[model samples]
Target: MTGERTASGLALEVLQQLWLGGVRDVVLCPGSRSAPFALALDSADRSGDLRLHVRVDERSAGFLALGLSTGSRRPVAVVTTSGTAVGNLLPAVMEAHHTGRRIVVVSADRPERLRGTGANQTTVQAGIFGTFARCHDVTAGVAVDGLSSLVAQACSGAGPTQLNVQLDGDLTPPDPDPLTWWHRPDNRATAQLRQAGDVGVQPSVSVPTDGEPLPLGPRTVVVAGDDAGPAARMLAEAAGWPLVAEPTSGARIGRQALRTGRLLLTTALRDEVERVVVIGHPTLSRPVTGLISDSALEVLSVRGRSGVATDPGRVARVLDVVPRVEAPEDPTWFRRWQAADERLSQLIDSGLAAAQGDSPRASGAPDLSPLAVAAVVGAAVGAHTTLVVGSSNPVRDLDVMATPWPALEHRFVVGNRGLAGIDGMVSTAVGIALGRPRAARTIAYLGDLTFLHDTNGLMVGPSEPRPDLTLVVLNDDGGAIFSTLEQGGRRYADAFERVFATPHGTDLAALCAAHHTAYERVDDLGRLAEALAESPSGARVLEVRVSRADRRAEAAWLRQLAEQAVPGDDPSR
Candidate 1:
């Protein structure tokens, strides 16, 4: 393990440890202090052990790591220089810490001799992330052997870890394996304390006794958020509650109970339910929060981890019940919730019918509407498929247009809901696809710009096991949805288009060709359906060309429909 013991070699050793400890993706924001680290990362990436994403902005890089971690259920590493660059990661670190997501932050720091002497781009980084991280460690220089153990510990930890490496001068790569350490087994006891769990810590609450039965009625609704998983089904079946599963919950879209509505809103169950059982963490929607907060119902929040309750102050009861695996044995309560959900289903069908109002289908070139494209692709995908929706218009459109599918029972939705940025959309989607089962098809719905933003994510070599996936790019040329934002007014319209929209004239087919991916362009809905039916068993791009100008009119139509559907109480009006 002998060489010129250089700082870059130490950084490389740390990265190698993480890679061997099951970390596959690393996000790097370039800086001079971290040049050696970046070079080592590039070498590792070339060696095929890890995928490195380069982001210019430290803040965006943090969020990109957060998104990748959230999607893959694995710790993602973020690399940056010391000082303000390291500080830029606070927002994402805080969010991940609170949400029980795992991440590792590696910051390049100045040498000790320069500390407290006003060195350029230097700050107190040893314990700078004290509150936000689970553990913090600093290395004087690169230690190949010790870095492996630290990497293992950080990977296994439930929250973020900060590793500050102080570089001396020139850099060199470390030997792959240095020394091995073994631990003696020991039992230790510590004092137990209880508190309202916050981010980065597990809750200590005891589970409620399964003694007396909960009041069973036909008016209960279960609201599930992202990653609710099998628990959503188990809870609904146990309590006889109708499940209102969000797009991101990854639970079955339609099964025993009806699956309709956008995050518990379309059903409008707030008025009917006397009790609401919430599982998983909070959602990104404001309407869901308002409905839950304003409802005159008893809310029982159940979660496996502590500190997951979004509204601890308003919850009638918080149970530390492990969802699905430890759900109650009773079936009486579930029957009532199921009944209420069925009633809501009827209402939704009636509403859709009324909205249609015998209007003949618009005759034209039979071009695909964004809603039509999303619905068709969503329906055609396999039950065990992993659906990754990009930020901006793709996710929102999918949420609105995706129909209730019985085949999507084992499906999961991966999105950048934490910070909702479009920078790493494709890369995160690809990472998520890689984590799932080999048989499962991973379909990513992305906008044109989003597809271009992380185009490097598609650079999977022939030797790599790429996911059996489809990349559906809804290429409307620009940020079509921004036309509806508040800044879309005449006064700021041009500036909004230039700054926020930032449309790129991308040749998507040409981009896919360069990456050696199967590419198809379709404007006709029928052809689009046929393309999806073929189901190519490799990374393929299905580009649906839509008119950006027409999006404005379609949104207007949807607004009118919502107005008529709700009547008298139109928010847009």
Candidate 2:
């Protein structure tokens, strides 16, 4: 090791120490102040010690890092220059905070003397993310041991961490003192701690230990929310209870899992649900919210590593883990849910198929409704594929349309359900796709608004690492989600079109052309499936033009179908 240090030497050591702490991916946005990190990361990438991803937009880089960390289940670092570039990371950092993603922000800053002195690209970078990320201020002259300790600490945290490094004098490395990736002993204990920390920090509370068994007398339903693991399904199956899992929920598989649980909850069965076992964070459906909110039902929420549990109703008994059932419930109870769910599922499928097959529109074109689009995308996912569902209508539609597979062996369905916001979804998918390079294919189903919001994610440098992702953009020309909500009522129809449905007629093909990305428009469901079937080679956009005009009417019709399938008055039909 050299006795005298330089900015590049410090940056290289930081990257080396971070790699040792289990960080395998780095997202770098080029900047003058952050040149040392850029060079250091390039060298690391060349040495094959880590994967480096470059993005011009810090916001996109942040989400890309978030996705990489999520997909890899390891700490990922996003490097940025000082000032607003660091602040641009707030959105992704906020999401990581709730989702428990290990995103390490390496924001390069001017020296302390330059800060608060109107220096170029310098500001109070420290503690910029506030509570969203734990911040560590690194000044010049910091020892290698201290830097390594900080890296270790940053790698093991509840959510995101920030290393605001201040560099002065020279930002570039001398030709003879090039930084290189060095070998280090495998610190298994630290690696394990980093992995364990991925679940997020646990809250300080006295609750039953993990794997505790609970009595099985009450009629319980397992509500598996986004990112909820298979434990939710296993618990439901063990207790012979119905599993109401969201589309992104890892438990959205197996026979016990209901395909139309959200809609089913709108039926008489909701009243009969004496107890609810919730896992992960549920943010998609209002019916599930109403069920858990009802004071009449007992909500036993499984505590997630995010240090918080889903207690939207504020009426919940938090548990350490998904409790085991002492004994299975009566076969009759499970059988009834199965029968009702089967009937409702059939109605939904038939209704969607019939609507797509025989449109009532004057144009005679098959109306590729959002729900129908979701169905095709969901069905197209093979065992080796990873489906990244966007928030809003697409995810909600998938929740209703996706059929529960008997087992989730190789396929994965995920979304940014932490904030449930539509921002950064495209870059998130790209990160996931890149991180999972071995996946047979990666597909992202997103609404038009969500896709447009992150179109900058499509701006990939020619030399930057690209993901083989097929982005299925359901272009309804507006925000269709609000149409199915209270805002879409007849009395509010006057304001609905202008405020709620804020349509933007952007030419998607031209937009993709600007990014130099492959673009194709699919109006038929059959062609959409065939397009998805083709092996993905590089980043491309498949735009499916759909109509939001009938969203409210279709929503009402679906609710009517659900009610007719299983009347609210009787549960034991």
Best of the candidates, lDDT: 2
Clashing residue pairs in candidate 2, if any?
none
Note the Cα lDDT for every prediction shown.
Answer: 0.64, 0.84
**Each prediction's TM-score versus the true structure:** 0.70, 0.93
What lDDT tens digits, residue by residue, belong to model 1 across residues 1-573?
Answer: 535446765665666566655677788888889877787777667766577877766766776677667656667899998789998787768766665667899989888889999989988887677687865455544355566567777876766888887887864434442221111112220111113112222221223334234556445666666555556655566655567666665554555344434333533334555766676654544545654564366777665332555454484476666333234434544443344444434554454455445533456332456666776666766666677878777776665556555643556676655446666666566656655545356778899887887787677656454656778899887888777666665789669868867777788888888989888888666777777666467788988876565566665565444433443442332
Task: After superposing candidate 2 on the true structure, give the runs of residues whose Cα lies further than 4 Å from its correct spot.
Answer: 1-5, 176-209, 364-366, 568-573
For residue 251, give model 1's deviation from the true position in Å: 2.2
Taking the tens digit of each residue's C-alpha lDDT, what string does model 2 give over 127-226? 9999999998987677767887888878877689999988777888777444442333357745765676633222222223367787878888899888
Give, for candidate 1, the lowest lDDT window spanning 10 residues.
Answer: 184-193
lDDT of 2: 0.84
